[model samples]
Target: MLEFDFCSTVSSIFSTPFSLGMFTEPLMLLAETAPPEVVAGDLAEPSEESLFSVGGILTLGMLIVLQAVLGFDNLLYISIESKRVEESKQSMVRKWGIGLAIVFRIILLYVVVKVIALLQEPFLNLISHPLEVHLSGHSLIVIGGGAFILWTAIKEIYHLLAVSDLGEEGDKGEKGNSVTKAISLIVTMNLVFSFDSILSAMALTKSLEIMATAVILSGVLMIWLADHVAEFLKKNRMYEVLGLFILFIVGVMLVSEGGHLAKIQLFGYHVEAMQKSTFYFVLAVLIIVDVVQGRYQKKLLARQAKLRLAEQPSA
Candidate 1:
């Protein structure tokens, strides 16, 4: 007869080399200060006796910091996407959309684990070149998420360039866009942004409690800050277009990454790939150039103003 035990099951879920490496030193200290069982079962949940273990507190802090780092890009994207709606409604949209999308994020976490297990099967065949790609769960997610972001970026760019005014007067073209339509677009894109975040959290731990707490806390923080970000973009209107273009670049990067994950190839080159470090390096150079150009332009304007004032006095 075969028998299963709770300790073995718990160990199988939480006992990993990486987890041990992260917790081992702190756990040793914790063991000396507190009971060994308490240190080991730090995450087992809030019991009456020990709801504030040192290990649990450290783990929560790390998760919060990680979530903050990951959520920065998403927050930027949210602020940019919410520009189409009325100024009064933009903050509400971001707050609610992000909060709702997290529910979907938790559901996707479970789905990805099952899908990754069957990722070896080839799902699509391209052509006579005999190149094939697996349409696994992650592939679909990457592709869908990428395509959605790309579409949003393109649409926003088009609206910026093609339309002279973005105020209510210019919304005649969107006369058919009901409140429902606007909210749907906002919510849809929120999910797209959540895709990478949820997948990243999955790699950290299979503990649903950890993932849920991180996401919930992050969502709350995002909601709190969404309005301020929206207001900042409004005040610094010059960079709105630049910000949208950055989002477009991010979308392209996502598509490239998705292609790489699915082993996609085009003309004998991997389609979905970019060195992240290189991308950031190039972006930094571009930002420096932009700053320099802005300073030079400002000085030129000041000099022109001085010359005009002198000429007027002489006249």
Candidate 2:
């Protein structure tokens, strides 16, 4: 009879460095000692499936949909930013900006896959009675991007409010933005927007090819849609305010997300991330209100015109 000391065997198993062999050793030993009539089947190593497999294809489709849903604010930003450039070059800016962003996004996806842990490691620690913030690389980037976007939205809103003459505003608009500067801003913000989608994609699948494909396809869609969105905004100028306010909300959402990631505490209160559902709900309310207000204003103007015509002498 072959007697085995279970405690010693377990101790030896743990003492050795972990490997596939460690798992197989016990099983092999069992097979060797078992009756001759009993036989063990060969263990085969796992192989990676091709990217075109059913699972991979499904993941790719899901990732593309995720990109589109997350890219709404990004698309809005691109449309508005492109308009800042010369009208003739606006389309070019959008295309080039999105094109460059696609390349950078792939690069970023690679980097994140390689050094995700490094990005999450907390680098900044500030603790005080009134304020507390533990910021990582990811959080800092998100917070900075959020701050810049908030500032831009607020500045534009102020400009709109300060404009007393439509003609002067039109002249200012005609001055336009430097093509390089506009494209630079669009590309930079596009990356900021990409972070969320990239992180979400990482959660979905580990395949870089799938994520990159989604990013490229989404960028092409944005380029194609950019002109239509900008033209709509141009034709319906009143909706510009609605767009700006939407951007303001996006900035707020980003700031809150960053704060949550950093575990920030202000005045002893913890900062929490804003839910996406809340954001969409607010957006829907804003759109509904805008549509209602526009129709109401048109009706009021028509009624006033009828009143004026009634008061005028017959002609």
The CA lDDT of each predicted structure is 0.59, 0.76
TM-score of each: 0.73, 0.83
Candidate 2, residues 110-229: lDDT per residue as tens digits? 776666666677899999989999998888888998898899889888988888996667545743589899889998999998887876665445566777888988888888888889
Per-model clash counts, in order, read: 1, 0
Off by over 4 Å in 1: 1-53, 118-122, 165-177, 313-315
TM-score of 2: 0.83
lDDT of model number 2? 0.76
**lDDT, candidate 1, 257-283, per-residue tens:** 678767786567666455444445555
Candidate 2: residue 182 Cα off by (Å)? 0.9
Error (Å) of candidate 1 at residue 154 is 2.7
